[model samples]
Target: MLARVVEANERWERLAAQLREENAALRAENEWLRERDVRREAELERVSAELAVLQRLVFGRSSERVRPSSPAGEDDDGQDDQSGQGDGPGRRQPQKASPRGPGGRAGRRDYSHLPRVEVIWDFAGGGYCCPECSSPFEAFDDHAFEQVDWRVTVRVVVHRRRRYRRRCACAGPRTVTAPGPPKAVGKGRFSNGFIAMLLVERYVAGRSQNSLIAGLARQGAQISSSTLAGTCAAAGALLAPLEEAIVARNRDSWHLHADETSWHVFTPDDGDGPARWWLWVFIGADTTCFVMDPTRAGAVLARHAGIDTTTGQLRPAEDGGPRRLVISSDFYTVYASAGRKTDGLTNLYCWAHIRRYFVRAGDANPTQLAYWTRDWLDRIKALYAAHDELTDAWNASVAPAPGRAAVEAAARLDDAYTAWDTALEAIEVARQAQMKSPGLQQPAKKALATLDREWDGLAAHRDYPMISLDNNASERALRRPVVTRKNAYGSRTDAAARLAATIWTVTATAEQAGLNVLTYLTAYLDACGRNDGKPLTGPDLQRFLPWNASAADLHTWAQPPETG
Candidate 1:
């Protein structure tokens, strides 16, 4: 009996020991899991915060949507693409003639410069007249006014015609051809104007197809997404050649600004992955041209600026060809050796680039380097301001204006140039001192050294009127595609990317030149279609541009608008 009692006690002790060991193992596992959960939570929170910041930068807050704000012109020098002539940003279009004026003429200029169309509502022979006076009210401000607001509307129309046919007296077949103007987008429900509107919205205004369809419907054009997309595709096909010709012409200029930005295509990665493409842009000296190549390599640059085969070099010559170019680009190193053996070719380095190095260095160490860099920029700013004021005066004079009074203006410009030279000399001395300063760290010192080395190329503007203070031209040309990358993601196929590059080249160039892009593009395409296999040239393009006679006189060359 004693032995049995002891055995029970031993069994209980063993069971207790097993329970303790299992409990301890569970506790350790729980602790490890708790720590792993904490780490995962922290990682998730960090990623979430970063994503939110990026979203805010790209798309703005949920409560408020962000629209792209146009970039401002960097400088007011006459070299800016904003030379009061281009059709797009910073440039002004010629004011169209108004239909009303003092003289009872048909084409009178409206004296009303502002938008307010004033009218005075006058009550006549009514018992309830003005409260202040029982007498009938007279016209207020010598006019009668009634206000109503209206919005633009677009609609589709369909036309059907029945042909008249007769049997010939000899029992032969006879038919009568009925015709009006050739259709632009054949058998399509939308008007030519509406299709043009769609393109302008997509390309110029930078709206997506969903946004565009919604906006057009709100404006009274009920277009399906598929319809709009199809219209866009057709327009792209029709306008492709004209776009190519415009790029070709621009590639033939004496000087050009070149740059590239990113783009994406749909289904780039077999409908799952993303692919990248580059939108390359080149603008001519007259600020009247543009070209887009899909490649960012030196080969693309070489192709545009003609090459000398034997020397394996690019030379700028009046070869009555496009080779005489002075390219303005960033310090990409790709453009570094372009002017090595090219005659009539010069590489003008960008001051903005040199200034940027100092700007960044100053950000890291403000007290010593930043202040000096800022001071230098302030002087540069002053020089630009003076140059702008002089240029504005010159523009107002319409320089060498067709009269004896123009002599004084010409002389004044020469005097202003002389003063500009003196200011430049002082700038050179300041730049030299910054390079010689030993207080800067390695990065700042390196930046200063580069400035000193490239001083001649950076300050080439002083010697040549055609040279510019910044590479803003190329930078500006690249802005659109960069904006596009965030929304569209990027390009899918190389063909789509090439198409985009071509389109940008033509549109931006047309805008830079103050030519109505749609007007020029449409007319230019029509001419190309009619010319058969003939290649488009600059002179041919001049005939169809917005500034040309054909825009207004479309009657002789173009069929008149259909009369009901």
Candidate 2:
């Protein structure tokens, strides 16, 4: 009995110790779960914030501007809302629509320049003699109102070049014939006007190939897609030399804008892997060039900027002076990398991009977002407004000595820069304070970090007045390509990609030169035809280049003279 009691007590004690160990383990696991739950909740909040920003990107206001007004609860222009406004935060006053001004009488549009063809209408006097009054009615004061109309004309024009045989009696049967006029394409059934219409319809108007063919079919042309594509591809060959000249103008320009977008191209002929290309555009004072590359690497930009791609260094001109360029672009690393590798290039950032980041950050934060956005927006307005004032002041103020005018301008610019720096200092103080606050959101923090990282680029324009503070020019220039991309999906085959770039180069540069796109293309094609399909030589090429062409040429090309 004693042995049994002792064994039973030992078993009971062992069981008690095991139960305590199990309880401790369970408590540890419960504590771990509590910690994980807290971390996961924090992560979920961050994700939710990001989702809100993305949603705003899809559906929010398109413009990044906030239109600076007075601070919340304060009246605009130093006026009280209620004549006794409260000190605490309050709602913004609703905007009122301005009254419309009296509209003047509408005037008729003049189209007298168009040729007129009058058709005479005659009636039989004998039929009118006996109907009602037994008196002949005479046509008096024929009514006429011009109606403008256009028609789809399908007519075959025959060119009969006169041939001459030897008139001498001793002639051995020799013949001479006058040559026919140049065609846009070699021996094609299409006229210069017809081919030009295709270029304008597809590229300038952003019409897809399928829609273009259907429209032409309705107009009685009934062109096949393969034919159109092949013609466009052929034109690319002729345009290659011209495109190189435009590219040269782009690189040589002191101030330029650079941008890039995705361009798709199928590679069935090349046996390439897939069809994704990058269409890079560079716009200058008198040139716009587009290039299609399979990669968006810094090397692609280096070549255009005259930077050494292999060593990532500047390739100075023979005179040992680097090219002077102030290039504006977004925060893409490639732009920055290219600018850094080249000594001549000074890359600047667009204020619009900076505003975009702040806008997105502000959208993601619901509470206190309005106050923050309004504050930053007001600062941005001040920045631009100050720059404008500086520009006006420089233009209006002249130094006593004409030789010292540039020096005086620089002095005024420096003063303005100093004043702007003061404003930025205040903004920085506010930013640093907000960053330290517990309520600051992640997006806002990220935006602040970006501004800090790109501060040098953002401040570039203040130092150099020639450089524009906004990349709006480049963005506007990019609109055409983006529209075509959306409509056509992208180019097909390597040839098509090259063709698209070539045509856009001509179209865009011609627009800059103020030449009508259709007329210019027709003239250029004619010039190519005259060159016997060979690449245009020095003077031959100069005649077609927008920069070199005379203003009279542009005006004539803008609208060809018509005779009745």
Candidate 3:
């Protein structure tokens, strides 16, 4: 009986050990499954966020304004409009003012700048006879009306250069013919004015070469697309020096707005197949410059901004003095990298871009994160409002080497600065607090990370009051090129791309100066023609720059061209 008892106890011990081992294995498996589930959930959230962004891009409104929902029982009218007027019950809504000022009907357009053509109608008998009485009616006064006329005619100009024969038989040729009118191209059929028109229509107006060719054909001028393209190329080359001058002037500015867009160049493969080029714009106070580069790297920035990549320093100015510049741009790494490398180079990030991040985040999960996104957008909007107030105060202040008005304006500016500072601090504090929150979502966290990373740049605008909160200037400058790219699909070759950059620089800079694009281009191309179809340089080029241009020249260019 004792031996049987020992054997049973041993079997029981073995069964207990097996149960313990099985329990340990099950726990290990469960832990691994939990970890894998966590990873998959994270991946799913990320993908869902990406999908939401893509959907918003495709179907959402382009404006970034975020309208928050009203609280519990409030109606839509509970919120005041931009003018602080509400349409709530018992409140009289203000009527919209007439756009025509004091009258319901819109005023007629003034065509005084256009040339007038007089056409008189008279009786065939030179006098009108009254039907009731057999008497001739004599007119003492005439009733008149004005009608604007438009006519576009393309005609061949035959330059009949007179020839003089040497009657005395001097030691020269028998006949001496006057030089033919300066041609924009060597032996090309198109005149300088024609080339200028083509450029204005194609580049400034964003018309495609094919469309221009067809238009010319309709006007009884049969010109091939290639020929038109060649004419544009020649004009671009002639204007290349002016483009360089504009670039130099742009780089010389203390504050600048910079932006770039993708451009396709088909030929002269840049090692990579079907090379993707870039068209960059840097707009100064008075000048806008465009540069075509194969790469969108820091080197391009360095080259254009006069930064020496090797030393990470700005090249000396013409007077051999240190140069300083503040660039307003999006949060592109290249701008930041360039800023870091060069001394005295500051990068002021775009608030609009930072707002876009939070905007996207809010869009990803609107129901859950809408309030959070609204808070951030409101904070950014406050910054803009504060800046505007500051600008208004400064503008209203009188000058004359700083007087009492300036002192008063400075005080007002201080108050405005306080508001701006409060708004900025609110953002920073919220960013910090929410970044540490345990319940934060991935989208919000990502937006916070961008804000945190770009905090220094976004706040850099405080030091430079002249700079804008957004890089909208550069973005606006790029729109013309983008439109042209859409129409013409970019240049065909590397040289063509460079030429495009040159022409775009000229046209865009001229428009910014409020100069008539056609008249300005015509004058420049005519000057080029007189220079033997070569580009103007040195002092001559300076005269064409918008800021340095002569008043007479500017006045002439500003006026509307007369029609024949």
Question: Could you tell me every candidate's TM-score relative to the true structure?
Answer: 0.60, 0.76, 0.77
Q: What lDDT, from 0 to 1, does candidate 3 have? A: 0.74
Error of 3 at 300 (Å): 1.3
Residue-level lDDT tens digits of model 2 in 29-57: 99999999999987886787788667655
Q: Give the TM-score of candidate 3.
A: 0.77
Give the alpha-carbon lDDT of every model.
0.54, 0.68, 0.74
Identify the leading candidate in terms of lDDT.
3
Per-residue lDDT of 426 in model 2: 70
Question: Which lDDT tens digits does candidate 1 get at residues 101-200?
Answer: 4654453323233223332222233222333333322221222211111124442232222233342243322332223222355545444445555666
- In candidate 3, position 114 carries an lDDT of 34
Q: After superposition, how far is residue 470 of candidate 2 from its true place, in Å?
A: 2.1
Best by TM-score: 3
| Shift of residue 113 alpha carbon in model 1, Å | 40
Better of 2 and 3 by lDDT: 3
